[model samples]
Target: MYRLKPGIKQNPQRRWELPDRIFFGHGACHILAGTYLEIAPLKGFHAERIIPGDGFAGNHIFVTDGEIAFDFHGYSLRNKLLLHHTSGWARVSDPGWYCRIEDVDFNLLDTRALNARKMLGPDQYFGDPRIRARSFLERIDHIDSVKKLARNVD
Candidate 1:
């Protein structure tokens, strides 16, 4: 028989609801995927940054309006992972896979500092960061492959 892992449970009432409008300038948007996001240029004149160790609890889903270049727990990557209408961004570390919304331009709003303070919180899980990183990297690889295939067909 198989058993569920600790902190992993099936919610009978789980649902997925996409927001009507997920654009920049919106305060904080909550999604059905258990992620909370805020747009860039949060409230100051600096680029927003999310450090996993700084009280950033739970899995976050961020969509940046502009390119976000940073190193996740030491792994460096340039560019935002997710994009949407609101120019919102996230910094999550959950083990589950997340949906990716594509085709949005990056914003250079100077609210990163303020948004950092407001957005920083305790994460729900601190499982293996490598596992989560690998998952995201795999997704990125898959996206790149699809894009290359499309280009080849064209």
Candidate 2:
């Protein structure tokens, strides 16, 4: 059985935000196609075509069957890493999409689901055993710290 997961929590302190201009819908290739057309000023990437289908929250966007192409500026390892890490199911949270890379097959993902699944790595998609253990320990530590602080206050 397919299991749908809850969306990720965005960091409230982050400075960056997705522009409100990007409208999401399930069969809205026209909107996506228009956004691609407008992004030409950026000069590095362009959408070749848009195939309409379902996405996260039942939104739609155009997506290619194979790898999507984009152009980059001069050699920069940091930029390369950013692009690489953000690709596939790795960057879903940027658009409020909740799907994860290692958890779902990309070929079968619709635009909405793909968007939702972006940004999540295998560790975030699936809980890490070590982290879970550490979290319990951290909770204990937090209680101890709070007790000490309370005693000092008293």
Candidate 3:
């Protein structure tokens, strides 16, 4: 059986703001999302909606096959083992001055789910959240869109 592990506890009143850092000439989180989405499938993994905060809800996520756990590279964040936008070396905490998402594990944050309405409604955006998430997946799949929406807050 799959489990709905506790994710982040965010204030729904606040909208997600873009990460202040410009990573690889684009928004840090966007680049993180895009790049990770680009690589996940090659390893037989798919993208899942997640909540971002100090750390991800779980070290594992439920997939159709089963549950998969985080693949931290011997060292994760000291900050509550916070999930990197992408996991592995040169990850969210270690994107360096500029880098790519290759050779990295996917984010532990991706293990957590974001309540669609609660997360998006405050921004006055009303639509199926899956649409946007899947769209981003498709974009990354085609290598056309490197932009991922950072729509939820922690």
Candidate 4:
């Protein structure tokens, strides 16, 4: 549930042949974070899309408001998010462990997120991440949390 590999362990591409739900916190992370970035403003919160530098694991996308990060696992301290993606290495193994956020680069709203089919290529493994993200938010009852975060920010 933490590392980048399918479910925190190495898996063949054939494993990814499953549904997007199977890869929720794994491969479909970009879509989840991108969905948050797209919806934050509408909910009255300001967030920036973040793409960790090469120092970290594989490609990962998340949103930050300078304090908290919103990703596939939901909200977390912006600083701690990197630790969750050490690519199976120890938390301290990553060169950016201490300053991962500082080394991160900003990304614009991902166009691929707009169409689930465009995310991972022609497979369309994920039907529509936006819908999935919304479902996750609702299922977790995070509407109030989102409102609280929004209210606390400028």
The best candidate in terms of TM-score: 4
Question: Which pairs of residues have clashing backbones in candidate 3?
Answer: none
Which ten contiguous residues of candidate 1 have the minimum total lDDT?
A: 15-24
Alpha carbon lDDT of each predicted model: 0.27, 0.29, 0.27, 0.51
The estimated TM-scores of all candidates read 0.22, 0.19, 0.23, 0.52
Q: Using lDDT as the measure, which candidate wins?
A: 4
Q: What's the ranking of the predictions by TM-score, best on top? A: 4, 3, 1, 2
Q: What is the C-alpha RMSD of each candidate to the true structure, in Å?
A: 15.1, 20.3, 14.5, 6.3
Q: Write the per-residue lDDT of candidate 4 for residues 1-154, one digit (tens) a residue.
A: 4334434333445444544555656566655655555655334334333344546445455666666666666666666776665443444365553223332233323454434422342135425545766666555546566567557664
Which stretches of model 3 miss by more than 4 angstroms? 1-9, 13-127, 142-154
How many pairs of residues collide in model 3?
0
lDDT by residue (tens digit), candidate 1, 1-154: 1222333222211111111121111222211111212221122212233223333332223333243321221111224232321123232334432343332232312235324544311221123222333333333343454355447556
lDDT (Cα, tens digit) per residue for candidate 2, span 1-154: 1112223124311211221121112122223333333433223432332221236332222322123322111112333323443443334433643422221233221335434634222223233322332332333343354355447556
Each model's backbone clash number: 24, 17, 0, 0
Per-residue lDDT for 1-154 in model 3, tens only?
1221233123221212311121111212223333334445334444333333333222222221112312111112222222343343224242332322122234422222222212222123223223343444444332211112112111
Estimate candidate 1's alpha-carbon lDDT, on a 0 to 1 scale.
Answer: 0.27
Of candidates 4 and 2, the better by lDDT: 4
